[model samples]
Target: MGNSSFFFFVFCFIFLLVLGTCDCLSDQEKDRIDQLPGQPSNVDFEQYSGYVTVNEEAGRALFYWLTESPANRDPKSRPLLLWLNGGPGCSSVAYGAAEEIGPLHINSDGRTLFSNPYSWNKLANLLFLESPAGVGYSYSNTTSDLYTFGDAKTAEDSYAFLVNWFERFPQYKHRDFYISGESYAGHYVPQLSQLIYERNKGVKNPVINFKGFMVGNAVTDDYNDYVGTFEYWWTHGLISDSTYKSLQKTCEGSSSEHPPVECIRALNTAEMEQGRIDPYSIYTRPCSYTTSLKRRGRYPWMRGAYDPCTENYSNQYFNLPEVQKAFHANITKLSYPWQTCSDIVGGYWTDSPLSMLPIYKELIAAGLRVWVFSGDTDSVVPLTATRYSIDALNLSTIANWYPWYDNGKVGGWSQIYDGLTFVTVTGAGHEVPLHRPRQAFILFRSFLENKAMERSSISI
Candidate 1:
């Protein structure tokens, strides 16, 4: 054979060999992360981030980051925990996954990642979703989808994502599953769990071996949230007595989601009185960029190591083309930049309920384990609000409230109700795990074990 012809034949043979080897693994297995941008070397656990198409005709897809349990190599025994973040338009990948509980956090420089020793993935296979098809890298081909989004549709799309996601990773088809989220997720988590519960009813041997759900500082009841928030502000000495009384009088029986003009005026007065402190965590320093707090010559975005002002770094990291390519995200070349919170989605959110207590009651009555936790320092969804909402359930207290300890110190407080458990992480704000990692990890481990938190002072 001629030399050129022989070389062409050899190339063809090698090409087929490479193609065959590449196609050997299942699509799901192929999705296993080889490496993430700026990931630390010598990492042991596998991580996957990509899109799961929930709707084909509409070309709608949701983004997810799945981190395998670092401590447990065996997938069969570990549970799968799905986490969502409540912004009505927030990216769970940005906040919940990258910033709070995920294995790695983007460094302040926005080009590197650091290990979070206290990540929840040590106990469970953590999945962080950027849901509703308009948040983060998730997108919809149908332009109208962005404009018309709400609680019901978000729940529906999320369930579809799960069903399809199971097909992709069948090894986890029957893995014990739990859902957890915070803030507006007070609406998202329970609503999705209700859907899962209802769907799993008639089917024998369901794909998702659903277990229970937990929410932190959730917005369960509008009235209670407002009352509790205003009461908390007053009790914490963040607002004046006159402003507090005005808030109480004007906000009574009012919707926090869409408050009346008088209620808005009262809230305005209270906010003005509270000054530049972060509303999410009263004691913690606010993100200088987001807040008006004065910092001499300190750029708002130039946060230091492990700073809680992570939004800026997260945004910069996700927007990097190399980072996007590493995760196989943003395949469609999204029109907008990556945002921690999506203005498009948040602006269009509709059909918010006045209360999720009824849904909680339904889930509790169905024998599903339910837990609600709060970061005591969070003024936005304070412990008082969660307490008031849980009181509306009127569940008989099985265990009296007591301090739960970790490492010979009081981690927080907890109380067990008949079918629900309530926990408070001391000194933590809206994002419990971010602020109090050890305590949050302890609470998470106890919740997964279905064991009571340690009440007596003892090292974890």
Candidate 2:
């Protein structure tokens, strides 16, 4: 530990300086965090209007969606946005509800909402969905109900979720819809979007009306996300100069080359976990965070890193009996763990299996719009990775690549391709909303207002 003190100090210093004025954590840590004062468990989540089950006759499967009504939402809405949590194994209820965007951002106090006026619900009626069954509140009564955890199965079930979910909320049927997610969603959003486009081509009934999609700091490609991230850490000075140089030489040279890939993967993952934080801010990173927020950058946008699965988020989530009960729900007996990470070999996604590129291409060909945005400082799924993945498509044209300014600083960059656009939300890390809510709100509104997704009528 002493040998690494210099790097650690530098990391701490940077985090403190960047987030010197963080407002989330308290000046008070000892004031008895609001514990769950022992209320009878109301895990009767099945009764809530927000939860709509999908039961197909072919299989006695049970899946659920938490639907927040657009009518109850602010009138500023435009479309019904479906958000899927990634991890290929994680639950959207955990991340989408408790952390990033929902009705609230629970403070350490546990009983309050730092009411996220910036919640995506502020713009579009938000749907936090758990899909492929056996995830979150979704379940399979029969063995066959669980779709094989793969790109194709995920897309099928997700598209099915939309088709059936619309049956319950008929109002949103004809209204425009958008698909979005992060991490493993690189496979989800695109594949599901393709399902919508393909099925809608000849149909008198189209459940997922074509609209734009959004992804942030996503895992869209294997080679790019894994390889490109190391370069980012080195360029940003998070990794030691020697380590970075050594990585470039040893790891950069291999792809199919085994034994060395895991080393490269770890080195790159370090850069992602190290987010922005200010040392002097008094708001510390989580106990298990491999690096400090100060060391990496608590990502100025999200502001802290407590492993989402830990009791640190208990008050934020499990404080409610419904959440607590769900955590212990008999999932593993059904062959899936209530997991935040995969412990099994080959876990879930063995490849950088991204989904949206095909969906984007389908949408572009059909004249629908598509966009992908990232928080510039996020090492989680850095911007270069997105770029390299999209390059796989060999998009034929380019339009604008310019700095997007906020508060007179280069907040990030925005670029337009033939049919898709990518933007970097400057100064932000992963979970763009938690980190840069205002900017994320602005980006979402741009898509809703039909300005950002609209292509110039003039053709070259």
Candidate 3:
């Protein structure tokens, strides 16, 4: 049984090993994008967009788009950064991918694309997910699932998506990973971070090497947000003294999600006083008269932008048959058109913790890198509100408030606390990258490098 038998066994083992490796690679290749319908011909990065079924029984699947770093960037050495956009019902693909930090941007014609020079993928492998079936191209077999979605369910589904996604792209399974998002994602980024952190307990080097998370213009503590928002409105001269006082009396201690009748009335009065302005970015011109009107009724608290009709372009581009086919999306041929944010999901949101402050405390104690950033001009989730929420944490300051520079100019102000870093992008809106891509790029680099923002006049 000597030489012949041993050599035969070794050859079979080698054959099986190579076969298994090929099979795994083929599974990943199924999701690869040969090219997008309107993508630039000169693109040098590998892009993949497809669905990963997270719940077979519920027929729930989440859609994801992964844009690897450009060829010269040494993508293997880069961290995998997952970007989410929070509406409880928004598409990260729409807000984060297309308009914010993704490599390709949709042009006004909705049938062409342009390169985003400051795309985050220039420094990291970027993954944008449209979570919680029923948003973007993601869907659930049961229609009712659309209306019952909430924070907890969204986080659970996203975690599941990540697990399954890693199986498809096993190469990234053990890569350093970070999650970042804006707006309601303030709730999402931390909640998911805590889940990953808790689940990995006692396990040796889990597949998900979740290192940290960052959120911009996020919704944190309700009480602090309420106080800070009212103060912002007053200080920014966007509300009357009477309306501000009314808001304070009625809104204090009230849940922003489910405010009392008096609070609702006060909010309505405040809106009237504030008038026809883009509440999201008070400093920028509204997208258009018609677009602003269309958005006003639906997203009173959270939409619009400085780029004006960027959302409209995303909506138009994503709904195209060719674009959907290119993205491997809308295969089910859903009855409705793709929207930037899902009204059904957002309107019928079932549950949200009144505060994310506890989660922050928990993660901070766990020694996860946490950063909270705000676009100083975003009235929707303004800098003042973020400041108020951070103040409530009572962590020891590592670096006192300092002006962080970008290209010899004050990009923003930053403060490094015991376990959290708070940053403000000076002229940005709720979607910082869209409004200020260069500064946002610098901010992202700093976050990933775990370095303080540049204090010198020279840019990195």
Candidate 4:
């Protein structure tokens, strides 16, 4: 309300999580949630502050834990924000805690506190969850424990985690809640949200008050997100005119695999002319910092500013042994396949047209406020794709096109209408909090205050 403004606008893009240390569930329910046959005897929901194991119906056992919201230090006044990391294979605690939100930085020393200036949990209780299985410390007594790891399986496991988790923290049963995540979560966030909304469809889950939802640089639609990379490349000077045109022609199919035969040709042409060398070329450098690495010839009129934290954050956070040991030391890599996106499992679940827009529309119809946001410069799930995807619903537009500025520059853009508002965070990539903490904080403030921003697209 002071000098701050809300966003309403157009696009979406995305890119790429974490953890062990589960806790939260009643002793009786804990016994059931530990539906695992021989889960470690030491794994007690009550004895441990984290690492509470959740037993699934027929899938691998998963581990999840809740951290009280950073904002509600009073304990009596704080609300709960359950955080999920995508990658039907990733861990929320690792990404949400180590990278984006959550308190304490597991310093390079692996045992020191650098203190993250921007942990979203500060505003509300943050619950980090590691879903699916075969990823992180989550496991199962059965090797056939893997359930094809699709959207259905993720929602099922997540729902089970909630049931057990809520039983543990019975006091938070009526707390206000918001569902959030990144990357492949395009599939997870909505499925879980729908499940929550459905469970509360008639009488509501007494354990909590379901609020709206949030996704950052998420994959709402695979088609648009894929094509958007070409548009973003052209706009950002990363691809030449020839390359852009070639991509437009060749990479025109909906297949998540290689672009169609024509798409390959376009890529080859672009590579030949513009000098791009990667095979999976549609994906961008997780963010601007990485783009800076590919910095090329002079753009006399362009600024050379760069951000060092973009793509390297996971390496920074997970390298800490204390952080690693927190999850019982399973995280192995310093590089990537940082599976925060679609789980490299059996099938594509996010492939469903079932994004949150319809769900947001339903929530809005019920008089709830809804906000969608993105990070600019993220070609992975570009803003253009978000706009294209949302336009299909054709929801009534309210806060028409405008600029959301920051640092005296056009950080990005926005648009709004009815209760659904889409906003873009300037200088951000796939993960908004990780790339633009200040802006992300400003966003949370507006969201909590009920003043949503409108942007042109959600970026990754």
The local distance difference test score of each candidate is: 0.84, 0.56, 0.86, 0.57
**lDDT, candidate 4, 1-460, per-residue tens:** 3333322111111111011223344453432322122223322222123334566444355555555543234644777777776644556655676567765444433334445666665677667776776555565555555545567767877887787667767777888878777766766787787787778867734565778777766766555665665676678676788778777765645454333667666654554554432211223432443343344211110111122342245444544455445433343232333233223342333334434457656666876556677777565566766777667667888777888655555666778867667788876766677677877876776676667443333331
TM-score per candidate:
0.91, 0.70, 0.93, 0.71
| Per-residue lDDT of model 3, residues 263-352, tens digit only | 888888888788777777788777775565554342334432333688878888998898888888888889999988877887778888
Candidate 1 positional error at 123, Å: 0.5
Better of 3 and 4 by lDDT: 3
Residue runs of model 4 more than 4 Å from their true location after superposition: 1-59, 70-72, 257-368, 405-412, 453-460
Model 2, 416: alpha-carbon shift in Å?
Answer: 1.8
RMSD of each: 4.6, 18.6, 5.1, 15.9
- As for candidate 3, its clashing pairs are none
Q: Compared with the true structure, what per-residue lDDT tens digits does model 1 show for residues 187-277?
A: 9999999999999999889999999999998889888887787789899999999998998888879765567788778876776788777
What lDDT score goes with residue 291 in model 2?
Answer: 36
State candidate 4's TM-score.
0.71
Model 3 scores a C-alpha lDDT of 0.86
Off by over 4 Å in 1: 1-25, 71-73, 289-307
